[model samples]
Target: MITGAQLRDAYISASNLIGNEKQKVDELNIFPVPDGDTGTNMSMTIASAAREVSRFEDGGIGQCASIAASALLRGARGNSGVILSLLFRGFAKGLKDVTEAGGQQLADALAIGVEAAYGAVMKPTEGTILTVARVAAEEGKSAAVKGASAVEVWEAMCEGAHRALAATPELLPVLKKAGVVDAGGKGLTLILEGMLSVFQKGIVIPSENVEEQQPEVSVKRAVAEWEGEITFTYCTEFIVGRGDQKAEEDAKNLRAYLESIGDCVVVVDDDEIIKVHVHTDGPGNALQEGLKYGQLLTVKIENMREQKRRAEEEAAAAKPEKQRLERAEPENDVGFVAVSAGEGINGLFRDLGCDQIVSGGQTMNPSTEDILEAVQAVPAKTVYVLPNNKNIIMAAEQSVELADRKVVVVPTRTIPQGLSAMLSFDPDRPQEENLLDMVRAAEHVSTGQVTFAARDSEYDGHRIKEGEIIALNNGKLTFSEKTPVKAVTKLAKTMIKKDSSFVTIIYGEGITDEEAEEARSVIASKAGDNVEVTMVNGGQPIYYFILSVE
Candidate 1:
């Protein structure tokens, strides 16, 4: 049995371990897309739990496990983050209401978390986190049955996780093609090794040499003195963890919870976790309630009014200094950053309160360094990042570690999800509550897109020819047609299904206005009478049309 402090230290150790080797894990991402962010996802996910575990008040092993579990869930960002959160959540459940956890309980907890993660995903895929976690839990269970101690069980789990991680490439051809293991799986193994490190060796803070912080401005400045023209204020941020309760509509319920607290909220939900952001007055209460569902991590708050006032003063001062375009020094309060592409998309994110936008997409993936600069540029107590593309999630995640201030990333896999997530923005709401709520709301949306095939392949029994327009429901290619409009219409029809009530079509660049309108009409006809259709100009490249259903 371990003490609460020991558990806390173990989590911190795990975080540092994963943080140190994030790039290696990132390299394992199978997708050739520039935004492969497996390492970043896992690191951010564990970091959320690490923050909670590090700050746990003196308590028994159960308390520590509970805290770690909650924090992991709330801080979960992508598929990887969500899975990591579940592993700990299961650990908490295994040790619930107990003073200390022995090897048996720990093993049980590991198994439980694995089950929870598998349960959450709509379609469980092997060769991913699920495989790594399942193997580790099994090893832990087998070791515990042999009268092993907690440390012994964890060691078994660590070894098992590594073994499983190593085998990921064998299980998935893409991983083999990419010449790497599963990024997310390796990340989980790193965390387990980190936990084991504390028990075997000792807590070792990542050296400043390796754990670099974003460079800070040389001079100290007033909180309200740095802004200019206050493009946006209220740099609100929080970390949310997953809750243990097996409640129906957990995501939807979380969304309702955030709605009660704030507005301007954006929530993105994946199989494993949810990421959220909002503008509201109750950042503290939001975080407190967020704890009920998960653990509390780092937080940041800024006064929007103060930011505006400072920006005005700076703008006035710059005029006297004869500075044209008035250098918009980063504010000292709050700031925002997002990952996106296209002028229209950038403008949309900016209008939604983002302070910085990193240009990226399916083709042009941003590197970790690009995202890191954006994170560092946002001069605030906390910085919020939105990785609107699944491929970019890892890169955006890596930026958090390189940043100086608190950083929370909302994993938005698609532009529709990104925009919908921001709709619930509430700077005043508690960060945790908003995060949970917005993420839940995002899950309600269904996404579709039309793009020309990049390669010839047989997917889901559909034969595709390169250069032909392909329509996708979510990420799965469903239709291949000669014209963009026909392909897009087919995707929109699939997106609506029977229950969908609203349909949105975002026309991209290279598409004529008449073609977009024609595509919309096809979807309208298929959607029946009650479904409403709305169209907009995204002016994005690549995809001919981005369709969304709610």
Candidate 2:
């Protein structure tokens, strides 16, 4: 018999197992859209249920499964998350009234979950999580039909899952090309392994990461978010030894003093030590007050303003573009929505008359929903989207279907192409002519990038190593260099032609001012006097420099 308590613990173990190894699953992605977040999405999807189930003390499987299904549906993040939620929803439905499930019941539940997952996807493909789940469920059902125990059914499911995962590449050509199994399949196998460990061995796998500071962190964030304006700049914490009979009086006075200088004050004391946590403008004064009680054992100070700024940046990245774009009814003739990564790059698009700029590029590709939100933010009859990165083009296209107003996606695979398209747009011309001109303008421009290799791999006969400086011409790896500065010059020279009229060097965040000037001088001298050389601070991430030749 399978109990709700065991299932709850099994899922918790699975969540942690996948969360700890998400990066590995992410790396298995061989697709052009290289966000590689399948593991993270699956882990987060299951974690939603795990967190909710942890709160309930009920041992009834029906009640526990219902709560988990509701939580998973609400918390599902991406495509993978949605599929994971669907599978669990089916599991809940199959075990609706069953408190303690037998081998047959468990097997039937697995089959139902697999069926629901397959039905959820519009065009279900093989060699994915669906395949893994389907195979596992079938194996479980087979074992159950043969009069196997619940433990035997689960073991068969795990065994079948591993076999299916290994065969995923054979079913998907892209996986074979990339020499990796499907990321979603791998994620499912890990989850099953974690669950099997608990169901078979009665041992719940512990997470390496401990949430020791979760309570304090929640309190800090709650107070920070509620206060529109931060009154205190620093967050200070200290622990002091309790000296003599006067320690309690000093601790009481310290609390009062902290309350006067800070908004959130927490002073806890025992017979041996006095612990204090406060947000204040002056950390020095806070520490000095703590010293009066006894010798300070531990002292920590953090700038709240900096932390808040970082939090805002992360929120911007997660939600939508950082630019202040207001949603309005379609009133104007036409507007533009450009996707870019850097602050300087976004500013350039804004200056070029883009109504909204979506924050995204390469590895951090924004979702279709994010692109649609940016499109809706524009107050134009027709909105044209320029996805600067190749990975973002598909998402930008997807937004066209959901947008309230007319959305025409001009597939700009690179930043330079997007800029060229922006430059070529003319209000005097008709919409069709303007679109045609933009596409042609993008086609004429050539793009070169200097970036570090993310991982070591043998691609196109080139033995690439991680951390190696690499150059890409148009979209293919041209060469590798020892240094960023050297790679910039090498790639620029390779891209420059005798008839090329303009060379624009867009330097990113990590490139120093001196390095930019050095590259500009070398390219200017090397490309010769006829071709004009110019440099601008792009402030982008990933690539050190983006060379544009026209």
Candidate 3:
């Protein structure tokens, strides 16, 4: 029998195990694009649930599973994360109201999870995580029917998962060509193996071993002549228990009060709690005002000036810096949210009518909650989302269910596609009409990308070397060159069709205006005088240039 506590322990062990092996799984990615985040996304998704589960001191097996399922859904990041969430959701459904589950019940739960996962995907692919899970569940069911113990059932499931994972290369030609099994399947097998370890060895893997290492902080004070005083000294955050108070009315009052005292105030209230974030000089006053609603569950106050000084010092020490984006209050009928990286690309999206821009693409994929937050910030009844990257589209779609506004995710696979889609938008037309027009516009445009190869590999008979500029024609690797200009020019020549008249080259962060112009001239020379070439400062990372031909 598996009790609630043991089940929780098993999941915790699984998260830690996956975290430890995440990089190994990441390296298995064969897709020529640099977005190798399946392992990280799945690990983070499960870790979110583990953190939530750890908070519950007392709960039945069903209650624990439900808590995990809810957290997984909300925290899901990429396609793998969403699929993992659906699997857990189905598992939770099977264990409803059960204090404990035995072998047969556990086996049935696994099957249910597999079914839910397969059902969720629009077109389920074989040899991926889905196949591995399905095979494991089927074997578990068989074992249970033969009157096996819970441990025996789990053992059978793990064996089946391993076998399925090994056979993935046979099912997917890409895997065979890459000389690797499915990354998602490998990740899933590691998770199941971790769970089996908990049941077999009575050991729970600790997260501390695989925890991310924090950079060393060295506070560098500025030269005495240019010191500035902080306007809002204190950063205040607290959560109020929603005891007998009406959440909506009290939340409104709380927001008003916080706004009066603070510069940056954000109050989010639910039936159970009222969470407050404010930047004010007087932290004591903010705490006093918060107490009027309910008892304060957690309180945190920090000196902003000190924090800022430390951050500056860290920047001076050569540490990477992260920019924080502020959320805007909702206020329009139709709004747009786009995902992209680089200041130039972000500015283009804003200028082209995107209300909110999420900073992510390629190597960095934003979570569903990140998109949902951006959606909520847009004060529109209907909001349109442009995911800009193919890998990010599924994550963006997951935000629709959680968003307060009607979210329509336009499947724009490239930044140029997103820009083209935005150009086709008509405010006067109905949403469905606009959707069709935007989708059509995106489809009509051909996209090409130039980026340095992260590793040396041969794909589709092309031998690519590390540090070489690689050209991708609509997500497929076409050619590799020693120079960006050669790659972009070659890519343009291939992308420009018989009727293609316009060519747009968006240069990234590494290229200067002169270099970009030279690249543009090279492209123009290759494309002939008939093609009208335009160059823009995209300033995006990873890719040296993004090309669009229509």
Candidate 4:
């Protein structure tokens, strides 16, 4: 049987291992489109659980699994993250109400997780994480049937996952053509290995490579260990009212007392109050020591191990939080939440009646919680979410179950598609009827993009070199060009049909207005007098121009 402590350490190890090596998995993506990194998304999703579960001390397997599943679902960031959450959600169900799990129970849970993951995907594909997970679960079940130990069953699963990962190239032609295994599958395999290490050796994988910025302060602070036994359990803080006239002179001795009992010690001696922050196993003892100086005014104590990663997250979230727009209560019958980046593109969505705009797109995919928050903020009985990027669609879909009000996902795969859907939405029409119209409108519009190659690669028979201009038609690589202007103009002419009536050139940042107008003129001159050609500044990164054709 696997104890709660064992499982908790295993989960933390998996999160840390994946988090530290996300960049390596990111490089396996051959597609030039700058979508969210699969490894990064998966790591963040599991780490959300790690942050929560780390706070629990010897919680039952059932309770820990439940907490992990809930956190994973809310924190899911992309298609990969959503799938990861689904897998864990199923795992949690299998282990429900159990303090510890035997080999058979663990194997059954793995099988259950695999089933849920497959069910969640609309068009479940082979040669992906789903395949790897399925094969691993099968191996685990086989090991359990042979009466193996819990650790033995997990080791078998890891071996099976690695084997499945190796075979992914043969199952997915894209991975084969790129000479790389499936990125998502590779990420899953890594997590399994990470967990196996802990199950067998009782050692959490260290995240030493993970950088933690040490801010210079007058007080000394120590970070909790990422692996092995944590030096301190509680992070205690308090304020003591000074009771003596010699409190200022005694402050030096107070600081010394805190250092003796804790690793991270901060004691600020003031004329009136002495503020202290320390990490120690004995919180009551520390408080007692503080009382000798004066009376305790305010006290706070937390698990220090959980604070390490959370502190890094707080620092990372600072910029996005400041940039995030405030959401409002529902005021209309239907409200829209669209995911996009850049001021201009966000403005376009906001102008189109989007009640809230989530700051994400190809560069970043917002978590399910992010979308859910936006959906709840809308002051409407019925809310519609526009993912606006194909990679973000699954994450947006997960929000449907979490949102309080009626939430609908339009399934828009591009910024242009999102805009077309918004234009098609008729407030006067029935909400359900408008959804069909919006989908149809989005389907009718063609999306063309001109962006630089993220890396050197051979895709769809096109040999693309890094830094070279590339054009894509509805998300497929078309051709390469010498300049952004030439690429946009050529792409426009190709996408325009004889029945086409309008063309809009949305120029991104780094592209001059002269170049945009020049491309518009060329497109207009070729498109004939009947086709209306217009241009706007999108100010988006990665893509030089986003062309919308109808």
State the lDDT at 531 in candidate 4. Answer: 95
> What's model 4's TM-score?
0.82
lDDT of 3 at 524: 86
- The best candidate by TM-score is 4
lDDT of each: 0.70, 0.80, 0.83, 0.84
Model 3 residue pairs with clashes: 330-379, 331-379
TM-score (all chains, Cα) for each model = 0.49, 0.57, 0.78, 0.82
Model 2 residue 256 CA deviation (Å) reads 53
Clashing pairs in 4: 329-379, 330-378, 330-379, 330-380, 331-379
lDDT of 1 by residue, 1-550 (tens): 7666667777877777777788777655532223436677677667767655643546788888888876665556555776687678788888888787788988998888889888867679999888999999999999999999988998999989989988988998767765677778888888888778766665544523233211110111222222111223454555555545434465576667766777555555554445656556676656666666565454667766564456446544654552122223456555677776677777888898887787777655555556666777666677777777876675466556556677787777888888777777677887787777667767777889888866455545666666778777777767778888888887776667777788989888899999988988888888899999998888888878888899
Q: Model 4 residue 76 lDDT?
A: 90
Off by over 4 Å in 1: 205-550
lDDT string for model 2 (371-446, tens) is 7888998999999999887656645665665678999999888999999999999999988999999999999999
Using lDDT as the yardstick, the better of models 1 and 4 is: 4
The digit string of per-residue lDDT tens for model 4 on 1-550 reads: 8877677777778887887778888888888756688888888888877766665566788888888889999999888898889888999999999999988999999899999999988889999999999999999999999999999999999999999999999999988999999888888887888788888987777664534112110112332233433567887888998866544567788778778887757777768898888778899989998888889999888775566556556655663543444456557788899998878899999999998888898868889988988888888989989999988999988988887678999999999999999999998999889999999999999999998888788888988888899999999999999999999999998999999999989999889988888998999999998899988899988889999999
Q: Which regions in candidate 2 have their CA more than 4 angstroms from the true location?
A: 1-15, 27-161, 168-180, 191-327, 367-369, 393-410, 424-445, 497-501, 528-532
The backbone clash count of each candidate, in order, is 39, 0, 2, 5
